[model samples]
Target chain A: MTPALDPVIHPIQRLRICALLDPVTEEEFAALRDLLETSDSALSKQLSALAGAGYASQRRATRGGRSRVWVQLTPAGRRAFHGHVAALTALANHAGDPD
Target chain B: MESDAVSAREALDAVSAARELNAERLRRPKRYWIMLGLMLAVFALLPYTADWPPLLRYSAAPALMILVAVVAAWRQPTAVRKIRLSGRMGLQLVGFALLGGVVIAVSRGVHLEQGWWWAPLVAAVLLFAFVAGVGPRMDRSWARRASHGEE
Candidate 1:
């Protein structure tokens, strides 16, 4: 079966976000922002896009009387991300092929 | 779009590199194991505190664990996101919990405290096996998965 690329995760920022979230069960929003080196609004925009596509989810909780957000990929998100990666691998493998 | 500009291979490599970087940077330090070691030491020494006040002896383990957790958290704030116990590591933990429980039950049932120091010895051995053996191996396996884009 062929793996299809997911347009939702095609952007570099979203792709990197998915890659980071792929291994972890959950990630703090602040930590993710720091790791991605993106502004809060930029990260939020990407997260919301993924979430709207049912590709991610976020939770808000209070820690030390301060609110914190944690994000994670959904099962659909994992499938889509892996599918996209597989598609990319396939493309990469054939990129230099001689016709 | 930027995706159109970057070759598929380059994008894949970038993603893989990011994954590896995250795995390497976010992994728990040896201090995490040290905290575990300290906790085990507390448990191992608990039974020997026969002369201490009952209240202090009973509460010591939880208190020490809390302190260790706080210190470990402070020392490694990244720990809050990384160091997840999953897959083989998760199974190993379940096995450890079950075996540890059985050992405790057997130790108390047989009254080995009178002459045999089997409980502490077994605890130490299991702790060593986990820290020195299974734990690192599990981390390696998890890192491989992370780098390879495995779920």
Candidate 2:
């Protein structure tokens, strides 16, 4: 089956977010921000978009006497992200095929 | 159409770069492995405690295990990304447990029959060596596989 591109994850920042979150159980928000090299508000905005789409979730926890936010891709979000990647792969691979 | 394809290729490259970055970030520091190895070593020596008071023998290992876990969690760096264990890592852990168990059992048997009191010591050293040597490598391998979206 041809994978469909997920509208919610199509943007570059959100795509990067999903890619970063894909391998981990969960990531600290600060870590994700650093990895993406984006401002906290920018990251939070993208995360909110994902959360609204049911593709991600975040929670706050206090560890070592400091409060921090952790984020993870929901199962639905993972499926959507994979599908988007597959669709992109298909599109890219089609470039070399005979017209 | 050609432009679309080019953009898609670029997007794919971005995905690859992101995954690579995540893989690099997922590596645990050497300290984590050292602590883990020490914990395993202690667990390896648990069999030698069998002759102690029943309360001490049974509770000590579990308590040590909990303490190590708490310390590890507390020390986890908030700036580094963490990866869930892959199937290969899980299998590696199970294999380590089985091997450790066999070694400890054999060491206990040897101590009983030959009075080789240092058998548990030998087992602990061997297990610690195995863990310290292989733990980091295994973590790196799993990080790579996981970032690349492999099982």
Candidate 3:
């Protein structure tokens, strides 16, 4: 089987979320929604998946008289992302080897 | 037969994507282990007979860096999830930097009387400060990621 077959993070949106999140410590809610090109509902769904898996954290705060939200990888999230990527790489490697 | 064919195609695509992601995850651990192993090996070569002060100074960096890296490797992402700008940790980190700087200056003023042993300590503190201060701001996208749970 390809390394991507079994992953700590599976869903495409969730993986995309991790991809965007892996680089920075935290990111803005609306800004990310724009980048992901996903609706608020779609993004929320993916975020919930990650949060439920203990891979990320979310917080709600207010600024400039408006509600704001933020998200970041927890230590566990980082580990999981790292593992997921590893799983992906392994799959890729296996495909090429074919031995 | 069209629906059946479509189902098979979807399964194939899903499997391929999963493989790709898993492969990427392995890269980090592989690099970490190789680097860590090399460092451990190099440290083992330091003469057992070196002077205490110099040894302490020299050992400070590699020892601490390796220790920190290992600890970070071991930490699940959940462990650092709650990092926040609480006044206490912020103050403590700032305090550490201030203390290190003051000592470094004082030692220099003493005509280098104090072995620059604390330099490595300061570097470590600086590294930690950068991570603590900058890490959160950089990965802010996780907010959206976490909220967009599953579809």
Best by DockQ: 2
Give lDDT tens digits, candidate 2, residues B56-118. Answer: 999998898778767766856532446777777789879877887888788878987988889
How far residue A8's Cα lies from its native spot in candidate 2, in Å, is 1.4
Candidate 3's C-alpha runs over 4 A off are: A1-8, B1-151
Least well predicted 10-residue stretch by lDDT in candidate 1 chain B: B75-84
B101 in model 3: Cα distance from truth in Å? 10
TM-score of 3: 0.40
Clashes of 3: 60
Instruction: List model 1 lDDT by residue over B1-151, tens digit each.
Output: 3343256877787797778877786555666666665576555545555568999888877898899878977845544435445566677668766665665455444445465556666655565455645555655666666556544
For residues A1-99, what per-residue lDDT tens digits would candidate 1 score against the true structure? Answer: 757778899888899999888887888899889988889999999999999999999999997899999899999998899899988887776655575
> Sorted by TM-score, highest first, which candidate order results?
2, 1, 3
Specify the poorest-scoring 10-residue window by lDDT in model 3 chain B.
B142-151
lDDT of 3 by residue, A38-70 (tens): 899988888887888798888888967989898
Calculate model 1's interface RMSD in Å: 3.9
Best first by lDDT, ranked: 2, 1, 3
- In candidate 2, which residue pairs clash? none
Which candidate tops lDDT?
2
Candidate 3 per-residue lDDT over residues B1-151, each given as its tens digit:
3453343344435534444432332123333433443343333323322445886868675776677567656744322332233344456548755654554455344433545554434443444454454434332433232232211
